[model samples]
Target chain A: MYERFWRLRGDKTTIIIPGWQSMSYLSDTSNICWFLEAEFAKEVVRLHKVVGNAVTEGRHIVVGTGSSQLILAALYALSSPDAHEPISVVSAAPYYSSYPSMADYQKSGLYKWAGDAESFDKEGPYIELVTSPNNPDGFRRRSMVNRSQGLLIHDLAYYWPQYTPISSPSDHDLTLFTVSKSTGHAGMRIGWALVKDKEVAKKMTKFIELNTIGVSKDSQLRAAKVLKAVSDSCEQENSKNEESFFKYSYKLMAQRWKQLREVVEAGELFTLPQFSPAFCTFFGQEMDPQPAFMWLKCEGDIEDCESFLRGHKVLTRSGKHFGASPKYVRISMLDTDETFIQLIDRLLAIQERE
Target chain B: MYERFWRLRGDKTTIIIPGWQSMSYLSDTSNICWFLEAEFAKEVVRLHKVVGNAVTEGRHIVVGTGSSQLILAALYALSSPDAHEPISVVSAAPYYSSYPSMADYQKSGLYKWAGDAESFDKEGPYIELVTSPNNPDGFRRRSMVNRSQGLLIHDLAYYWPQYTPISSPSDHDLTLFTVSKSTGHAGMRIGWALVKDKEVAKKMTKFIELNTIGVSKDSQLRAAKVLKAVSDSCEQENSKNEESFFKYSYKLMAQRWKQLREVVEAGELFTLPQFSPAFCTFFGQEMDPQPAFMWLKCEGDIEDCESFLRGHKVLTRSGKHFGASPKYVRISMLDTDETFIQLIDRLLAIQERE
Candidate 1:
């Protein structure tokens, strides 16, 4: 998908990690190397400013193998060692599916996975995962349980300018971001957390140390390169008409969303979520829907929308996987142009048959 | 130091990882990729055969970020979910210092770190960690506790040809190896486990997946290249005169051990452990002492050998840190040539003054 875009940029986005580089177990300054730490912090701050999604000031940045690892690390850091019982971990319904498995796989006595936040009534310390511009559904959300005793981990994975409007800079105690969704470099597996509390950061660092020693210096170096390229393109003057990464991503996603919605609307047998125009600070104008995923609800006796889509050879994640109704399904809008075209064609053919 | 040797080899040891080489979250295969996994397995088996140290036949190869992560993964896999209580984890005295901390850090309900294996009596089900060519003492060790309920995880980080003689092919159910000690690429942080049981391997795989998704593909690729280079060097008929990694490492370690022994013997204030010359299958001769660390015991009024060494501006890990007596200290024989020379000079000076 983005490979074409990256190819167009050629060596501008290229990174080369040399052998014998970072062979020492210890990083230069801190547990995380000074070069990597500095680059990550600077790029993250710059990206946030350019996108207007998250506030990065006064936050201790801890890097991980990916946001997936950091998610577990954050949970480990938040859970108290002295607690008599295991801390409960919860997220809202229709959440990212991997949350449950990752939290409980270790079967660590420190924390246990309790279901959705709405149903969790346990009287103890808990960590609520808040994924804004949620995975299954493309709606912005907030913590439903407003308790001082609970800690919130804001997983802002899909809150970049390409997926959603930059309504405001999210100010949270602990927030996670990854290069996967932001730059479509998921293979690199570089993710970071912005932690306000030093103690929490320290604990998270320990978790990372125990988990994989630390993130790969090579990956970190590459991530730093990719991030700098993105920031440079955005900051460069007269580059709006140029092939900027975000612009390319936003335009492609918006076009896909529009085409899919048009076909579904014509079908009249299914409906898509309605997202009105929203102000985007980065683009300096109102933007249409450009979600990472398209949430589709089956109408007129289509109980299993995922199965129905599969019948058309268009595979989608069943809504039941997200703790939602079977009538709904989540289709990724971020596939390659060819795949998206095939999806649109299949969807339109279904409408014609109906 | 090995840097001098590496400089001599020049770009032959160089590895360049491209920017977009491995960007997918998943590998080409399962926990590790097909190419890397096959290369690692083949190289590991070949190396073991060359060194005649560990049995690789009928073993399942599991790669990790490092042997450190695999240490915890092994413990997690060995501990049963239905166990009446947390499984006890024990290692012999002068064990790897990080074992206790790594085992109990998560405060996992699955396992608890018990003290040295010699005093472990209350254990119903236990996992005994056996680090052959042990960390501080550098002695080949076996599990003292011969109980049916006790499982063993052999940390073979020091089992390479440079550190110890190839006595026999160790046929342990669970054995851990790392690239750090083997190739002096400690920065790469690649490790592997040779497991005899499929169930245990599956559990370990699950643990890694839940931990960091998996080890870095970039690191894995680099490791494969390094391992292949090592194997190629060792297998070549006339390569003994060439820059073979093991040959170079052995020569450096053997020389360092001899020099350090001479100085300590002249000092008379400290006594080093006496290791008898053993026949090495790899070298096909009775090799001189080449332990990774010099276990120095204070002979006179020096109750704290580590402090005495520190007073002379030589930094060495304290014996107490490895669950040994303060009278003993462990000096690394793997330091840079300059550092080692300075250490020898300091020791000779102290002896001359005394």
Candidate 2:
């Protein structure tokens, strides 16, 4: 896990927050997102540049409690306030399970959930969430609607070099990234959006202001320090001798995927998505896509894959939650080593019974 | 002023967060509020017990990004899902300015802001916000509706002895508190709610889960440390040698209030609220109210009090924001020493101009 890299670094990545530091609600009052700490924004830009994941130049950064909040903020900003009805929000099938509920939980008049972007045929303005190297099923995706009326929110949570090949710097009107997925710091609850439109950015900032006042400054400072360490590890001279954070993470993912594939091949009871090798600009070589989740389909008459897996003492998200059939389930490839091993072992045991 | 106490404490109140710490989303998965950090919750309970401001026994603690988020969550939890229309949310006149916007920003179907709790006569399932030692005005409040159908959310953000007399340990069914107002750690963005009902607590937790997934574990841990330090300062058992956090804070507030009163008396243009001495259980003595804000009402001629003060280079929140007459303005008493002194000097200059 990424924890090992941080653990080895020791105090280099440790952040000491004095009691008097960042005691005010405002971080940079002049900034569009006033609550965003300047240092945290700087680090976000630096990390994206280093990874070649997203374009940050000329883009406004809006920090949030997490990408979850950002998702709703994007919906709120993109939707027409004066519209006759709530704007429809859609994501492709097998999308993030929480997306539908998050949009509709408030039952906001501004926006409402309209499931499965692929099948969406509404005649008005709509917000499409495009999660690349998507959750549940880790396939590279583009906006399915491909219509001028469709506003896009690109959730690039798993676009890091460790999970997939960095094709190019992603250019989008609105792109979201989280420290949780990139640095494995989920507990920090820090995420940001790179918005091209100033009006949209301001609206997003307003949403955050009305939501939680602002994101936590303590977490922001901590994130800044952690990100600095990450960038520092890769930029250091003679870094070839020391494994870079991405390089280390990439190797681990590759190993895990290799192990998982071999088990699946032996079991012959499930089918995992096949991804063709692609050249990674960051790594400067052809690399296999090692996604954070294994989208598994039950073979031959296994109608309920999630329930079947649970029977084997292996838990997974039912495809039903993702607006797909129960024959498919998504299992995380990013849990701790012990837990991952236990999952594989349980799967193998189920395979033996067949 | 409280910052001075924290700065003097040096490393004792400081929090050192390692890069590898709290990397997961879950804090205490077994608790009713799964995202609530055990340490933070423990410290919250400990602080409440130490201060005797609120009862913590058998109360479910739901942690949030801040009290702003908790306010929304309380509304979400208390509102009936089966209600024919959005539940009416009412607070007394000159209420916290943000309450209306925060409630209706999304134009949520669950609840709608109905201003001025004192005038709210509409029946059937209304939410009444009672902010004891209220924001802007600093007046003690009770639910004015006085009906069984009225659900109450007690915002105890300024209930500390430094702001007002802690007359009794508040035993409200749902009470909210924030570290920002209590400890002046606004940047931490931590708040907690003590809920008596199990279903309500779960619903509040669900609201948080959808809003941000969870509160920041880093901030929670930092808050835990800050609060522990606060309680420790009071329970040092050193024969009254060292000043407790509240004792030091109370002295600063008392002094500031005295100076402001003198300046206002000389100006003869602004009338400040009068407070009768009341017994404080924690302090074990009668004490005058020293609120975090100065609610100033213009005597005559100056119709727009906020604009009038702005002319004197003293920035204050206009009463219009709090749904009050332009003759009144709210000035913060919690700014830095330099800012407070500048405000006093500016007011003295205004008096001379008169």
Candidate 3:
């Protein structure tokens, strides 16, 4: 797990915050995203440059509570406030499950959830969420709705070298990335958006300011330190004792995927999507996809995969939540070593029972 | 000024977080508010018990990004989902300026901002916000809409002894508090709400989960440490070497108010609110109100006080934002010593110019 890497680093990543430090709500009043700590912004830029995963030059970085909040902010910014009806917000089938409820929970007059971007019809103006290395199904994706009136919000939460090969630096107008998936720091609730347009970025910033009065400065500072440590590890690649963050995480992910694929092949009860080897610019080698979640399909006569797994005391997200068939389930591969091993053991037990 | 007290305490309040600690998003999965850290919740209960400003027993504690987020959470929880129309949200005139926008910015169908709780004569269910020791103008407030369908959310952001006298343990249905105004740790963006009803608390938690997934664990941990230090300071009453947090802050606020009042009286350019001394349970004595902000009204020919002050190189929030006249302005008394002195000097110069 990525935690092992940080544990080995010890006090190197520990941050000390004094009582009087960061006491004010404002970080940089001169900037559009005034609540974003300058140090955090600098580190975000540095990390992206080090990994070459996303384009950061000339982009306005807007920090949020997490990419979850950023998604909402993007919707708020892209939708016209004075529209006669709420703008239709859509994503391809098997999109992130939370999108529908998150967009429509408050019943905001500016936007409404319109399911499945591919089948979205009768829409005048729409916002399309394109989640590459998509959740529920770890396949890379692009915007499905092609229209002049369509605005795109790219969610690249799982585009890191460990999960997927970084083909090239993503050059999108608005891209969201979170420390939760990248650095395994979900508890910090830190995420940033790379925005190409100044007005859109300002509106996103305004949404955050209205939502939570900006993200937490404590989390921002800690995220900066954690990210700096990540970049530092990569920079010290010549030192045999130091392990590169991506290399270390990629190894762990690759091992887990190998074991999982073997179990599925032997069991013949479930099938997983096959991924072709791709050359990664960041890793400087060809690698198979080692996604953070397994898009598992129940083979043969299994009607509901999630319920079957639950009967075996294994928890998995139902594919129905992701607008997919009940025979499919999304199982997380990002849990602790103990949990991952237990999951594999449970799957083997089910196979034996069969 | 209380920063000096914390600074004097040296590294006693310093926290060292191991890299692998608190990585999971789930804090207490069994609890309704799954992301509320156990340590932080315990500290919150302990602090409330120590201060006696609000009741903590048998109350469900919900943590948030700040009282700002909690306000929205409370609104979401209180409003009926299938209502014929969006529920009207009202606060009395001179309410916190951010309330209207924060409530209605998304133009949510769940609720809409209806101005002035006192004059809310609409015949339907409504939510009233009562801010005790209210922002802009520090004064005790109660629910203005007297109806069976009226729900109330109490924002007690400035209820600490340093700002106002703690009259009694407030046992409201839902009460909001934040560490920002309480401990001057605005950067943490941490707040909590004490709710009497289990269903309401659960709904509030859901709102937060949909909004930001959860509050930041890093901020919650740091806030817990800061609050524990505060309660520790109070408990060490016998140690003359250690100044209690409330006593230190109360003295500083009291001193600032005295100096400002003296200047305003001598200058005869403005009028300030008069306060009746009240008994404080926490301080164990009667004390005059020393609010964090000054509500100053322009006298004589001054039609717009905020502009008048701005002309003198002083910045203050206009009373218009608080639903009051332009002849009034709200000045922060919580700025640094240098800024406070300069503000006083500027006011004195304006008086001399007259």
Q: Which candidate is the best by DockQ?
A: 2
Q: What is the fraction of true interface contacts found in candidate 3?
A: 0.67
Runs off by more than 4 Å, candidate 1: A30-42, A237-241, A266-270, A299-316, A335-354, B30-52, B237-241, B348-354
**Model 2: per-residue Cα lDDT over B171-212, one tens digit each:** 999999999999999989999999999999999999999999
For every prediction, compared with the true complex, DockQ reads 0.50, 0.84, 0.73
Model 1 chain A: ten consecutive residues of lowest lDDT: A28-37
Between candidates 1 and 3, which one is better according to DockQ? Answer: 3
Q: lDDT-based ranking, best first? A: 2, 3, 1
Q: Report the lDDT of model 1 for residue B109.
A: 78
Better of 2 and 3 by lDDT: 2
Model 3, A49-159: lDDT tens digits are 999999999899999999999999999999888889999999998989999999999989999999998889864899999999999788888888889898999999999
Clashes of each: 3, 1, 0
Query: In candidate 3, which residue ranges exceed 4 Å CA deviation?
Result: none
TM-score of each: 0.91, 0.99, 0.98
- TM-score of A-chain in each prediction? 0.95, 0.98, 0.98
Residue-level lDDT tens digits of model 2 in A73-165: 999999877899999999999999999899998989999999999899989789999999999799999999999888999999999999999
- Give, for candidate 3 chain B, the lowest lDDT window spanning 10 residues: B1-10
